[model samples]
Structures are given as C-alpha cells and as structure tokens.
Target: MSGGDGQPRDGSGADQPQPGRSEAEESRRGAAYGFTAYAVWGLFPLYFAALKPAGAWEILSHRILWTLLLCLVVLGLRRDLVWLRDLARRPRLAGGVTAAALLIGVNWVVYVAAVLNDHTTEAALGYFLNPIVTVALGVLVLRERLRPLQWVAVAIGALAGVYLSVAAGSVPVIALTLAFSFGGYGLVKKKVGVSLTAMQSLSAETLVLGPIAVVMLAVLTVRGDTTFTTDGAWHMTLLVLAGVATATPLLLFAAAARRVPLVTIGLLQFITPVLQLLCGVLLLHEHMSTARWTGFAIVWLALVVLTVDTLRHRTGLARARAAELADITP
Candidate 1:
C-alpha cells in the first residue's frame, strides 16, 4: 500500500507522492481561502450601496454591534473566554487592541462613507495602494528589512501618487485615508503579537468599540433618525447582513494567513483591489481617466516586482534549508 516515499501507491506505482506536492496543495488551498476573503471585500461596494436608507454612521454602529454579538457567540461555542481574561490582566496588550480597534473602526466608517458617496473607484484605489503602505509600515515601525527590489517597489509606489495627481485631476483624500488607517491598524495588530487568536483579538477590539457604537445607535434611535426602525424589511436585512459580510471575510483572511506563507499572502492581497477596481469601473460604472490608469499601471508593476522578489527570496531560503539537511544527512 505504501511506496518508498511513504505515499500510498497502487501496484502500478502511479500514486506515489510527487516532490513538493504537499507544499503545492497548501498553496492552492491558501489561495482559495485568500480569494474568498478578497472577493467578498471586492464586492463591498454593492453591499454598502444597498444600505442607502441608512447613513454610514448608523451602518458602522450596527456592524460593530452585530460583529460583537457574533464574536461572543463564536467564543461561547469554542468555550474560549480565557483570552479575554488574559487581556484584562495585561493592560499593554489590551491597549494595543484598543488602538487597533479605533483605527479599524475609522477605516470602516471611511470606507462606508466612500461607497455611499459614489467614491468606490477611489476606495478601490486606496486598497490598491495598501500593500506598499503595509510594507512601508513594516520597515518604519517593525524595523523589517527590505531587499533592493522591495525598496525599488516602494519607490515606484510613491511615484504613482505624483502620476495620479497629475493625471487624475486631484489627490485622492479618501484613498489615502483608507490606506493609512488600515496600515496603522496592521502595525498595531502586529505589535499585539500572537498571544491572542484572530477571533479573540477582533472580539477584544469590538469590546473596546461596542459601548460607543451602542451609545451612538441609542442616540439615533431616540431621535427617530435611524433607518433600522423606519426602513422596511429589505433595508433591515442588508443592515444585519453587514456584520456577516464584514466578519466572514475577516475569518477567511485569518484562516488563509495561517495556511499560506507570508509571500503568498502578499501576492493574494492584490486580488482584492483588482476586483474592486473592476467592480468600480464595470459594475458600479465609475469612470477612469488615462492618467489615473497610468498611475495604477505603475503601482501594478511595482506589486509585480515585489511579488517576484518575495518568491525569489523564499525559493532561495527553501534551497538553503534543503542543502543544510542534505549536508547533515551524510
């Protein structure tokens, strides 16, 4: 039943484990998970657009409230409230999560506002710019080293801004806001470390924001300005679905992060903005100027360089590891 490689094989020897098959399978599954997350994120313009009766503020509040409820339910099912207790014992970690919560909360608000205001193209541009922002954050805040190509990639990303300004008529404030806010959130989460699981960290973040969200919702309800009570079933449904939309992609992203190596994850990150840009132009019927396209082209090339550089570095490391093992074997 087993071959020399320990793979289950038939008499024909046709089913033996191929070299690097496990790694390939893992990469495939990770890409699938990453695609699921980014795809959901790409389609967010439609989701936010559908919530027209509700303002961004109300929608964001409900998202926080419902996401908290969902996280609590997950915790109950998993029977893991230990992380919450641990957070209470550790103020520094709690503080980090709190900062991350605030940052992501602002990101949500800005993103929702952008979508509702017909700035989906700009929003997509923001996401397109995010990876380099993340890399820059890593270098500046985390003290991570970058290769020569990576540095060139960052510089190319920077030049895209000038191109956009010249060709796109003006600077994209919404795009920059989204890029920096999410970048800062990523930095904070990185600082928070792996002590808390994704679910637990998200729960902790929501815990920090939930009270404010509740108060805001309560105020809107009292003033009879909230769409939740006034809007019909369709609007209400979408509002509730907002939490699922937000949480599901995040959970998928976390799962993908665990399964995929960092380089693959970086490659997968581009899928989101590409989808968003398509949604913006094709689905949402937004316009794109030639200059804007040129700028986008530059950033796209930079991402290609960065990804290739990452893959090359990882391949080199893998070869080095294999050589080390071979040396030890003799």
Candidate 2:
C-alpha cells in the first residue's frame, strides 16, 4: 500500500523507502571499505622493503608502467572505453586528472624512497598529519567554514608540527611532502567527483603518466641498471605484483570516497598511520626519540578532538533527520 506522502508502506504503515536506514547502511559500508584500504596501505612498508636491489627510481618506474598496463588490460576486458571519449571532451577534468597524476607520482616516489632509506616512521608521521592538511586545504582552497572544534583541532596540529620541526632542528620534509601531495590529490579527486568508476579513474591517471614511466624504464634498460631481468625470478615476480598492490587499495579508496562523507574518510584514515607506526616500531625496528614521541602524542590529541567533534556532529545530524522524518510521516 501507499502512504499519503506517496511512499510505499508496510502492513504497519511504516514507510518502506527508509532513507535514513539506507543512508546509514551506505555510510557503514563505506567506512568498512575505507578501513580495509588504509590497512592495506599501512602494510606497504613491508612490500616496498622487499623490492630491494631495485632503487627507488627503478621501483617507481616499474610501479607506474606495470600499474598502467594492468589498468589498461582490465579496462579492455571490461570493454569500458567510452569514458575515454567523455574525458577527452572535458578539458577541465582532464587537467585535474593530470594534476592528480603528478601529485600521486610525487607521493609514490617519496614513499618508496622513505621505505628504502629506513624512514618509515617519518612516512607514518606524514600520514598522521594528512587529515590536518586535508582540513586546511578545505578551508583555504574550498573556502569552507569550520566549526570551533575544528579550528581548535587545526591549531593543535600546527603546534605539533612546529614542535616536531624545532626538536628535529629541521622541517620534516618527507612527512610534509607526503601529507601535502596526498592531500592535494584527495582534493582534486573530490572536485572531479565520482562520475567515473574506480577502474576508470585509475586508468586515466596511469595513462597520463604512462609516457614518463615508459621512457624512464627504457633509459634504465639502456643503462643496464634495470633489475627486472638482473634480479631473480622471485624479485621480478614481486615487482610485477606491484601493479596489483598499487591498484587494489586505491580502487577501494575511490569506492569509499564515492559513498562516504569526507569527514568519515578522514576519521578512517587514522587506521593507516597507526598500522604504519606499528610496522615501523615493531617490524622495522626504527628508532623513535622522546621528542618524536611527544610530537606524535600532540598530533594524537588533535586527532582525538577532531574525531570526537565529527562523531558528535554526525549524531546531531542523524537525530535531526529522524525528527524531520517523524514530523512528515502521518
């Protein structure tokens, strides 16, 4: 039967559309996908560490080339080339995709270098700062208004950054670079919207950078510095599998972004840094000084404030939505 509001109702007259319930379910699913993506990303140190005997540059080239090849194969199999036609017609979006490709390229190279150089802890710190950077970008670039608690969180994060820089007697360049590059990439992705599927987006990004990767690999081969052939079959296999490793979490992340709010995505991102921190301290046996620990503690405090505010805000919105629904239902 149909209710007065034109919505379908069950025997008890409860509305069947259940917008609130469906939205909550989608949010929950997005959170799950985001968590899984970050968890995989957190374990990246181990994977990169295993790709040794290959320098950062060589590894990056292989990663780009292989990932591009993989994306193309998948797209071809799916017979999903129509998006390319659409993308070609939209110069603005194409430009955004190019910018995203460059930003991610920087992030990937820096990350690979950090792992190879035993800077995993610093890389973890970068991710820990990512949410703060993301929020700052929203304020500065998107011109979004922030609540008081958000302002407080941003202030605390800045303090933490300053303290870390002073204690180290230098700016945390790797951390800052990773945080900003990824933050910018995220912002561009958000602006681009989710009209494209995850696979399509990946394919577009890789295609943009595909030429550079190809040239780099060719140069490395001519110089006889390439490891794909010099390394044993096991090493070669690991390098090839890099395509799958790179694409999987990114695809999940894109899916999560499509389904969830940016705040929810930010909250879930803590998982990646926490896991990376553990990997650094326990697995890689990286040194963590008292000063570094203190800085991280301050960052944690900021994150706590941000997370609490987000939860409360979400709860308030949910309750208001429920009340509005109740008022409309007769």
Candidate 3:
C-alpha cells in the first residue's frame, strides 16, 4: 500500500499517500482561495467604473453604508455578534478598529475619486507602490533591518514615484493619500490582538463609519441631490456590487492568508495592481505621456529588484529553518 516516499502505490503503479492526498487537497483549496482574492481585485476597475455616474462622494457614502448593512447581515446570519460585544468590552480595541475604519474610508473615497476623474492609472500606481510602502513601514515601525539591495530597491521606487508626481504637474496627492491611508490601515490591523473574524473586523470598521454615512446620505437626499433616483436600476446594481466587490476579495484574502505562506502572499499582492494597469491602458484607453511611461518603467524595475531581494530572503530563511531542525536532531 505504501512506497519508499510514504506514498501509497495504486494498482496502476501511481504513488499517493493518504496524507499526501489530503495535503494536495488542501493545496488546491488554498490556490482557489488565493486565486479568488486576486481575481476579484483584478476586476475591481469594472465594478468601480459602473458607479462613475453617481459621483464619487455619493458612491463613497453608499459604499460605506451598504458595506455596513451587508456586514451586519452576515453577522446576524452567522450569529457572531459576540465579536462586537467583545470590542465593546475593550474600548481600546474598539478605538483601534475605529481608527482603522477611518483609514479605510479615506482609502475608499480616494480610490473612487481616482477612478471617476480619469485617474484610474494613478490609482493603479498607488497600489503598485503599496508593497514598497509596506516594506518601508516595516523598516521604520518594526525596526526590521532590510537587505542592502532592498534599501536600494525602495530608493529607486520612491524616486520613480516622485518623478511621476512632479511630471503630473502637481504632487500626486491622490496616490500618496491612498498609499499612506491604506498602509496605516495595514499597520493598525497588525496591532489588534483580538480574535475578530474577517466579517467581524469589517463590521466593526463599518459600524464606526455608519453614523457618518447616515448623515451624508440624509444631507444628499435633503439637498435634492441623491444620485440613486436618476442613476437607474443598472447603476444601482453596480453600487450594490460595491458591497460584494469589496467583501469577496477580503474574504478570499483572509482564507488565503490563513493557508498560504507569507512569502507567497507577498508575491501575489502585485497581481492586483498589474491587472489594474493593464485594464487602464487596454480597456479604459488611458494615455500615459512619455515621461509618465518612463516613470512606470522605473517603478517596474524597482519592483523586480525588490521581488528578487524578497525571494532571496525567503530562501535564506528557509535554509536557516532547515539547519535549525537538523541541529535539533543530532
């Protein structure tokens, strides 16, 4: 039943252990999870595009409000209100979630504005630069030492971003705002020790935004400026998809984060923005001037360097792990 490699030998001479089979199944699940996350992120431009007619501010308010409602429904269905109760018990954790909530709200608003104002490419650039920002944050906040090559990569990436900002006339305020807000969200998320589910975290974050959303919606309605009435059913559908569009990738990301190695997650994060860039160029037919293209090329090269450095680090860590295990055996 078993082979030298602990794989079970089938009647057709194929080796497959039950444990290996289980592992293979889990790997499949993890790939599906990761794929779903990246795919949703990749196609987000289409969803956001449909909501462009509604105006960014109104769409942003709806996103915040509807996401909150949807999350509440999810919590009710799962009967997981305990996370909210837990947060209530610890006001500090609630405060952190509230801060995170504000950060992501700003992120959503900026992203919507970028998409609406023909700056989809800029939004893509912001995301392309996010990994580097995260790495820079790790260096500053966590005091993790980066390899020499990584530092160089960060410098190059930053310089490319600055070049693009300068070339675009004004500083790329939208890009920097998007990156810093989302980066801060990531940092805050790292601090919370509470065992909140992904839905719970989203719920808490949106709950923090709910009152503001209500006020915004009421103000818009009273001013005879609600976009929903004139935006038609098709547009409304797109607005609602904001909830699904926002939540699905996050859910898949949560599952993938639990299953995959951190190195793999780090590698996969590039796919989203890469797809956004392609969508902006091909589908949206956005133009990048020669200098802007040059800046993009520089950023791409920096990312390649950073990625190689990361792989080297991961390999080194893996080797160190193997050596530690071997030492324990003898």
Candidate 4:
C-alpha cells in the first residue's frame, strides 16, 4: 500500500492513507458537481425574473415549449433517442411520466407566481425547508429509518415553517406550493427509476406538456397578448434560454446525484435557497421582517444539524466503500 506521499505503508493499515484522501477527493469532486447543481438552481431567480410582466401562464408556456425543444436537441446529441422511443412503447410508464409532467407544470407555474409576486424570499424558504421535508416523507412513505438528530432537524424545520406561516398572517401559499410541489416531484422522480437518463426522463415529462404549451402560445399569439414578437426579442431569447438553463443544470445535477450520496445531496440542496435568499434581499431588495428573520434563523439552524448528521452518515458510507474495495482487490 502507498500513502499520498508515496511511502510504503504497513499491510492492511493502508486505509489510514489513501482511503481518507480518496474520500476527500471524492467529496471535493462531488461538491464541485453539487455546487454546479445548486449554482444553476440558485441562479434560476434571475432567469425567471427576466421572463417579465408576462403572466405566469405565458412564462410557463415558454418554459415548457423551449424546455422540450432543448431536451430533444440534447437527447439527439447524446444519441439517447432510443430510450425515448422505448419509453413511448410502454403505456403505463408513459402515463406515469405524463402525470409527472403535469405535476412539474403546476410546480413551474407556482414558482413563476412566487417570482412575479415578489415572494422570492418565501420561495427560498420553501426550498430551504424541502430537504428536511423530503427526509421526513422518506421515513413515512418509504419506511426508512432516520437518525435521531435528523428527526430533530426535520422537526425544527417544520416548526419554523409553521411559525413563519403564522407570522405572515396567513398560510404562505408560495412557500407551501414550492415545498410540496418540489417534494412531490422528487418522490415521483424516484418512482420513475434511474433506468432512464435524466435527459430522457425530463424530455418525456415535458413532451407530455408540450402540446398544451403549444396551444397556449398559439392562443396568446392569436389574441395579440403574446410576447412572441420580434419587438419582444429579448424576452424570446430569455424564453429559449430558460430551456437551456433548465436542462443544463438538471443534467449536471443528475450527474452529481448519481456520484454522491443522498445525504450529501440533501445537505448541498441548502445552497440554492441560501443563494436565493441573498438574491431576494440584495438584488430584489425584498423586505424580511424580524419574525421572518427569526424563522429563517431557525430553519438555518435545522439545516446545520442536518448537514452535520449527513457528514457523519457519509463518513460511515465512505468506510463501507473502502472496505468493499479492499475485499474486491486480489
């Protein structure tokens, strides 16, 4: 066995050397991938922000149409068209995919409303709380065991959400919409299985929505209320960019999600909300009351606990991976 410095190491004691470094490198690479994912997700506010005074439906239509077009182009580039073709052959799977597509469409429209209505901060909070919600849902729905600390973190986040809702004088519809929709989306994607490439799956999902999106765009154009004119060039450009922006990060996220552990991904999910919160306050100059700040602090604390637990979980997984690798070596 060799150390990072290349000195001969004691037999079976090699783990102290390469294993730590290997895991660290893996984590670093994984973080880079994960960061790329969050960064893309984080920057989404700016993308949606640019879609403009166009109502949520119009924005959604452009998103669906361009996203489908981009996904098709991407599938062709990757030569994964066969997977898509095969998907069309299975009626049940196609139906499920179609249902998932509608769910995502609803999620997208809700997100746009949040952005347009100056609820980006609430949207951030929603995603911020989503990881914990996902963890709790996993326990309830999938019969997964949660570490005690994880349970506490999830509880803390849930309480913070409730507090925030009351503080806001009503249910924070935008936050709830973002949270449940995304949480539900994640669950559905899991049911969809990893048999398909991320691109293929997203393409199929969007393809189901494509027809409706096309009809909406056409109707808007016919009524002269559409943002499809050459005078709307910048908006149109942003519209198409939405598809590229949407697909690229999702593809990056899929790459990272496969290479990293769920805990790692869960922990990394915090980045997007953090960025969005900053963008909301800094760029958009949105007001956050003291109660809102307090709620955010509570959520942040929960995330910290969740992150620590994930790190511990990842350490155990890393050790198991090293042991498995040693067993397989001649």
Candidate 5:
C-alpha cells in the first residue's frame, strides 16, 4: 500500500504541506483510503469472473481503454493535462513509467486469467506473498534495515513459498509472478520519486499502453475473437465497467499512498488476499486441501507476526509523540 514513509519513493524530497491539514489528520485519512482500496481489490475475483466470454486479453484491453477514457475525463476535470508535457521534458522518466506500465499490465492480464481459469486460489496466494516480497525488496534493493521480527516474518514467508511448491508438487508460478511483478512495480514507482501523482502516473501508463490496447481490441474484433463482437449488452456493459473497476481502486490507492506510511499500508493489504481466499474457497468452490491450508497457515502466521510488530511500533511511536506534546504544553 505504501512505502514506510508514505512519501514519494523517488528520493527527491518531502511533499510541500497543504496549509490546512495536520499530519495526524492526514495519516488518519490515508489509513481510511488504504483500507478502502485493499477491500475493493480483495473483491476483484467477482469482477474478473463476471467477464466470461471475454478472454483475459480482451478483458485487459477493455480495462485499459475504458480506464484511459475515465482518466482523461478526470484529468480534464482537474485540468491536469500537463503529463505529456512533463514527460516530454524528461525522457528517462517516461521510460521508467513505461516499464512500470508493462509490469502492471502483465500483472493485470495474468490475474484476470487466473481468476477466470479457476486459479483464484493461486492468485490469492500470490497477493498474500506480495507484501513479503515488497519487504524483501526494501532490504535487498534499497538497503533498508528490518526489525528482528520483520526479518523473521520474511524468513517465514520464504518457507511458505517453499512448502507450497514442494507439497503441491509444482512451483507456485502464478503466485510468484503476481507477487514479483507487483512488488517490482512498487519498487520502481518509489524509485521514481513523486514526480507524478498516482492518477497522473496511471494516466501516463495507460496512455503509453493505450495505442496497443486499441489495436489489440480492434484486431480481435475483426477476427471475431472478442467478447464485444459476440456477447450481449450485459457482457458489454460489464466489459466497459472494467474501467470503473480498474480506476476506482487505483484512485483510492493513490489517495492512501499519500497519507499513510508504507508499512501501515502493507499491513492493511491483508484485507485483499484474505477476501480473495474466501472468494476462491467458499464462493468459487475451490478445494482447500490440508497441505494447502498448512501453507496458508504458515503465511498467515508470518503475517500475524509482522502485523503485531507493526502495531506495537505504531503504538509506541504514538505514545512517544503524545509525551512530546505533553512536555511542550504550558
């Protein structure tokens, strides 16, 4: 959900404060946004599952195209048309965003396919693995330090991955792909700093990818290989609604990213995979073998450790801040 500081990962600098808001209030708002975003993301199995008759490619294209249209409208409303101009001035930044777009786009296609292909359990596992992946990225790539319990959580996560692969008699490719792609996406976005807000960044990513989405949709239509050509109005409506599905959670995520610490966002991400596991097991009727359950239990235990550590840290920090304020009082 966010880097530890909830600030831009780009290493550029601090955000200029909005005059009216207190930092405490902003963090509260951020936590709310982060929770909402993850909750919506957790329910995405229903969204992708409903896109029957359209393959993942078709669904992804519709999502991109519609999301692009929606972003354009929103940007227009905000009068934020300067993305292109700003990118033009910074070719390296454009390249970075393009790379990020591809990672996320690939992640999207794979996830949609997983949902429709009855690999929702794998998909859910993938997201559960993602925060651990993100934390690992922080340590390895950014040279960040981890608390002892945080390191223990990461180590346990590694064991979970190994157990799932060994017990399942196959590598958990879907879960690994999802975790790595999204983890890498977060890493790159942070590295790029806050040159662009989340909306602007997504707008630019879709813009870069939009032409290809158009061509792909057009080709599929011409070849009679697309849902739009064969499906009824309801299907088409759902397809177009992919834009709404895509945009809303992302917008909320952007809002949250600005307001919360990355670790806080990370902890809240549990909402998503937990919901997804429910959808996969209870709703989709996927079998949950004892071994699979064991694997999940290990991961869940790791999350419990991580969550407890994070909560304690925050509580201690809050008490310290309160004492500081008290000392300053008349």
Candidate 6:
C-alpha cells in the first residue's frame, strides 16, 4: 500500500486545479474496491460450505490446479511472462517464492478443513488474531521495535490466548496455525520484496504447487474418489469458479493498494474477520460460548489499542511533514 503526505500542492502555489477533488474521488474508488474485496473474503465460508462432498484435500487440489490454469491464461494474454525470466535469475527470491507457496498451501488446506468441519468460528478467530501475530513476528524475526501501545497490545493478546486456552482446556490450534502460517507468509513476501503483480505472484506460487496438486488429483482419481468428474455440472462449475473467486479479491486489493493510503487499507482489513465472525454466528449457526466471546472481546480490545497507535503515528508523521514543508516555503 502507498500513501501521500495528505498534502496535494502544485507549482502554482495555490491548492487549486481541483487536486483535492480528484484525490477524494480516487480515494472513494479505492475504498469501494477494498470493501468489495474484503466482503468477498468474509463470505468465503458460505462459498466453501456450498462445495460439500469434496473433502478439504480435494478442494485444495482443485483450487490450486484451476487457479494456476486461470493465471497462466491471463498472463499469456497480457504477455506478462517476463517476470518468470527475472525470477529465474534470482535464486534467493525464487527460494522465498517457493517458501511462500508452501506456507500459503498450508494455510489454504487448514482453512478449507476448518470451514468443512464447521470450525468457521475458529477460522474467523484466526483472522482476527492475524494482525497481532504479524506484529509479534516482526519483533521476533525482523527485530523491529514496537511502540508502547504495541507492547501493551501484544501483552493483552497473550492474556487472551491464556484465557482461551484455559477455558477450552487446550490450545486453539486451528486459530494459531492459521495466524502463524499467514504471518510467516507475509514475512517471507516482505523479505523477498516481491515485485510481481497480484496475478503474477499468484501464478508463480501456484505454478510451484501445481505438480503437487496434480499428483493429489491423480491419486484421488486412482482411488475413484475424485468429485470433479462424478459431481454434476453445478458442482463442477463451482469448483472451476474457485479460480475466479480466489483471484478477483486479490486483484481488487492490489488496485486498492495502489490508489489508497496504507492506513485506509489497514482499517479495511478488519472488515473480513468481522464479517466472517458474523457469518459463523448467524449463517453457520456456530456456537459461541461465553468463554469464546470473552476471549474475542479481549482480542478486539488489543486491536483497538493497536489501531489507535497506528492512527496517532500516522497523524504525527503528517504533522511533521507539514512542519517541514512550512519551514522550507517562502
């Protein structure tokens, strides 16, 4: 995500030419895209639920295979295969992309398993905890220093984990696995400084995993357990549409990131988890005991602290930039 200094001045020395209007329009458009992307992500439980009779492994394999095919077609049409040559020359980046592929594959399988097994609420909780996990990973892996509020937020998050574990009589393994896997994936992508477009990145990652997915499908076929052929046209279509479903939000998110501020994207990220939680409680009718609710509440509190810190930090940066500009002006 990119951001401006919140100041749109021109050489004319007057904030005219309707720059503010154009910026406002751009921001509005980006926000719309971001909202749609997150909304789609939030409603994924319903989509996965509809793909029944196909186990998690089957769904994951088809998702990978079809997504890779779709991405290849799109890239070919756009003549965007130059990145492949560039990636071939960078061994470290190639390794990072491979690691990213594996991590995301783990994430996809675990998520499918959670949704299929009616653990949608747990899946939602995992996403809700994702930001906290990312922050922890930055501190641990990147040796980044945290702000005071961030430390407080992390401490609160830890307390919530303890409470949840004690209340449930065990660790929330599904949630933690989802959070850590995704966090690690993000870290790897960041370290690699991925320059690929959304489609290109998806293509690269899926290409790495395509062989495994093919092998999985072949084994399923040998065992007469494949649903792609046995399932009717409707089921087949849904499975095939998985590629479109997977890529659309990602493309939208990339568009939004280019047009909007990082802070706006950060705020929008919460929409997905919030919607997922609602879907689990309302649509899926997943049980949310008092203990679970309490744990979620604590996590939300931590998020509130973290968000406040972020906003304040952004505001401070904006003010500092304005002050510097004023000092340099005639």
State which candidate has the highest TM-score. 6
Each candidate structure's TM-score, on Cα atoms with residue i matched to residue i, is 0.89, 0.88, 0.89, 0.84, 0.87, 0.93
> Could you give candidate 1's per-residue lDDT for residues 1-330 as a string of tens digits?
000000000121112234566867866765786677777777777878888878888998988888788888888887878778878889889888889889888888888888788788788778777778889989998899999998989999889877887676788788888888888887776776657766676677888999999999999888877998678998888888776776677766665665567776667667667777787789888888787788889988888888888899999999999999999996
Q: Write the per-residue lDDT of candidate 4 for residues 150-257, one digit (tens) a residue.
A: 999989998898898888888877777677666766666566555555667667878899999989888888888776565477877887776777666665565555
Model 3 residue 85 lDDT score: 73
Model 6 spans with C-alpha error above 4 angstroms: 1-21
With candidate 1 superimposed using the best TM-score fit, by how many Å does residue 115's alpha carbon deviate from the native?
A: 0.8
Deviation in angstroms for 216 in model 3?
A: 1.2
Evaluated at residue 21, the lDDT of candidate 3 is 49
Candidates' RMSD to native: 8.7, 8.7, 8.7, 8.9, 4.4, 6.1
Whole-model Cα lDDT per candidate? 0.75, 0.79, 0.72, 0.72, 0.80, 0.82
Task: Give the per-residue Cα lDDT of candidate 1 at 256.
Answer: 64
lDDT of 6 by residue, 1-330 (tens): 100000011121111223455877878877887787788888888888899989888988988888899989988887878989999999998998899889888888888889889888888888888889999999999999999999999999889989999999999998898888888888988898846766777888899999999999899889988888787999999999988888777777776766688888889888888887888899989999999999999999999999999999999999999999999999
- Prediction-by-prediction clash tally: 0, 0, 1, 0, 4, 0
lDDT, candidate 3, 46-162, per-residue tens = 667877667777887787778778878877886768767777999879888888888888888787777777777777777777777877888899788988988988899889878
Q: Which order, best to worst by TM-score?
A: 6, 3, 1, 2, 5, 4
Ten consecutive residues with minimal summed lDDT in candidate 4?
1-10
Ten-residue region with minimum lDDT total, candidate 2: 1-10
Question: Following a full C-alpha superposition, what root-mean-square deviation does model 3 have from the true structure?
Answer: 8.7
lDDT of 5: 0.80
Model 4 ranges off by over 4 Å: 1-30, 258-263, 319-330
- After superposing candidate 5 on the true structure, give the runs of residues whose Cα lies further than 4 Å from its correct spot: 1-33, 256-264, 319-330
Q: Ten-residue segment with the worst summed lDDT in candidate 6?
A: 1-10
The candidate, 2 or 5, that scores higher on lDDT is 5
- Could you tell me how far off, in angstroms, the CA of residue 325 lies in candidate 3 after the best superposition? 1.6
Best of the two (1, 5) by TM-score:
1
Model 2, which residues run further than 4 Å from truth?
Answer: 1-33, 254-265
Kindly list the per-residue Cα lDDT of model 2 for residues 14-104, writing each as its tens digit.
1122356577786777677667777888888888889997988898888888888888887787687888999999998999889988888
Give the alpha carbon lDDT tens digit for every residue of 1-330 in model 5: 211001123211123335599999888877887787777888888878888868988988988899889888888987878767979889789888998888888788888888889988888888888878988999999999999989999999999999999999999998898888888887887787668866677678888889989999889888888977467999989998887777677666666776777677667777888888899999988888999999999988888888888888888898999999999999
